[model samples]
Target: MTSGSDGRRPVLTGLGAVSCLGAGVGPYWNALLAGGAAPREVDLPHLNMRATRMYRVPGAAVPEHPRRHAGVPLGAVPRMAVAAALEALDDAGIAGPDRADVAVVMGSEMGNASVQEERRGAGGAGRPRWTPLAVAGAAVGTAIGSRRGNIGVGNACSAGGYALGIASDLIRSGEASVVLVGAADGVTRVGMGGFDRLGAADPQRCRPFARDRAGTMFGDGAAMVVLESTTHARRRGARAYAELAGVAWSCDARHPTAPDPDAAQLVRAMREALADAGLRPDQVGCVLPHATGTALNDAVESRALRQVFGPGTDRLPLFALKAMIGHTSAAAGIFACLTAALVVSRARIPANAPLEQDPDCAVWLPLEGPLRLERPAVLANTCAFGGNNSSFALTGPGGTT
Candidate 1:
């Protein structure tokens, strides 16, 4: 007999997503495995980002379905969040039309890129600021609410993954037995232009950790998970994707865009994560790298990764979501985390399209294949421009994994 969800450690029971690849975790996973689409050209209306080659979820549809109260607005960040959250709720069985014992933890990196644009426009005209949608639009917690879980975190690019980590904590604290954690971001002209100005965006595409990589291509999407303790889960006869084992975060406080090259803080965070999980660096089956494909980030992360995991850290399986879906800012962290989970569920990771092994990345790159997992445990890493670094660990339940 299986132990009740509450009796067992907290684990992710369900997942939902709306990414540049597509809506729904199933579609995105299929596309990712099929190598259906890589980033491409697009126009961001908010910043009037014209003639820009960016990553986008092709044929993305936010249908005005009756199920979601007329559905979310197509192509909008909030819309994506709402859609993804509802789907996550449904997947988690939290949608038994019950709103109790559930809370929402939502995080976004580009939160309401349009609001800033409007604010900038109004400021130029000396106009007073007041728009209900402006703040609400970007607020992930506001975008979607759950019966018991609602937490918002913005740790730069680590926003979403951090949200999941904190939600796991909330469960550990019994704040909410079930937490709906969400991460979302928008690809507005303002957002993309800001990165472009920072020289963090490629005019064409994203090639994470690639030696010839230029910069990340901006993409927009949402990713979320429903986490619950084992006792509650079994009481409700729920299934679980994996148990959330550990998470760690740190800040270099170095530069706004450039990371602490040595990544001392970053390495410590990863080590702490492994320690929290009671696992060794060598036990790490795979590492979901935060390779932005930029010279500095890749170099810094590579250095830190090698230092922590050492010689064979490169032997660890590596899969960069940005290479296929582009970077979703706040969404990147959790999306990558979900990718880790997906790898567990699928027991394989898709190839990195549009990305080739670089002389530098070769030391840390993993082989692409009919991905297989022996233990179903994974480590996901993220770093932000403001020196934010974090790592989280999770594993499949039942030892059946």
Candidate 2:
């Protein structure tokens, strides 16, 4: 089933976030409007890379409970996921008993790799517990008392978008009334080392669509949103932030690490997602592009936007969220979605991070300040390695074609 003006449509009712800005949704939104936070030096064991800056989560922001899951030491990633999940459940009014049937879906490329990294740094002289990529979802499931299925997605950076799509399908197909969908990733030695080795780690900050953009910076955090069927939400009198109208996915098997320079698959994903939502290119008020400050990625996405939106693409407000929050990798898609939902609910669009606009990426970005959201519907795109791409559309409550 697809979203529409019907009872089966999926709508977002609650949001939770833990980012460099802080731990709550209020702080995260306020920071975005206040021009975002600056990157800081992060000292990791054996991290000997020229690019040492990242939007690291403050020590106080991580939760203290669930220190260990089944004898495996829970790292910052799982802890942050737990915190965000609890907050989202509370916001959605899903008490412990009510959440027994709620399903959970989380996306994370690295998962709790930090625990293993620490062990390796300590000479591997401890118990043989392993923290796999499913730890984040498992941690949340255990915390929320969710007896239903718990699925973990690892589609590289676009994992969060895929997870959201799966949750929406479950709700629409009558398999679950509500789904706790989220993504979480903590900066790991391997992730940092790999990027540094590939020369994709930006030395300064994340400046997407910038002329002098070097590469992308990594950020660590978790974001969660509670999605429920329109009928179930109305039955429970749960307030909705926005309707998740549509989602589409595609893959460009042509390249393993690089996006197809022609961007044919990316363009198709955008068009199909809009079509699924029954919206025209002109109806989308804003977009959150997967602009990761990479040279070719930014340029290719710019060309794709022009192809999908035509000449009017210049007028669309593109929220370069990664510029402010850094690329949260696998969690980025959900973070972008949560940001879009806030734009619809609050009727305001946060300003983009300042940058010397790149001519090749000729997309409009409002850097002056927050602007009134003239249109209610928004679109967000996410791409990952292996050429996996996903796009989703969202509209405000009571939105009509």
The parts of candidate 1 lying over 4 Å away from their true place are 1-8, 45-51, 63-75, 115-149, 362-367, 398-401
Once model 2 is optimally superposed onto the true structure by TM-score, how far is the C-alpha of residue 336 displaced, in angstroms?
Answer: 0.5
TM-score for each predicted model, relative to the true structure:
0.87, 0.97
lDDT of 2 by residue, 51-161 (tens): 988998888998888898877788899999999999998998989589998899999889988888887877759854564656889999999999999999999899999
lDDT score, residue 296, model 1? 79
Model 2 pairs in collision: none
- Candidate 1 C-alpha RMSD relative to the actual structure: 4.1
Q: Mind sharing the TM-score for model 1?
A: 0.87
Tens-digit per-residue lDDT, 319-401, candidate 1 = 77777788788888878777887787667767666456676755445435546665566888888878888888766664333
lDDT at position 193, candidate 2: 82
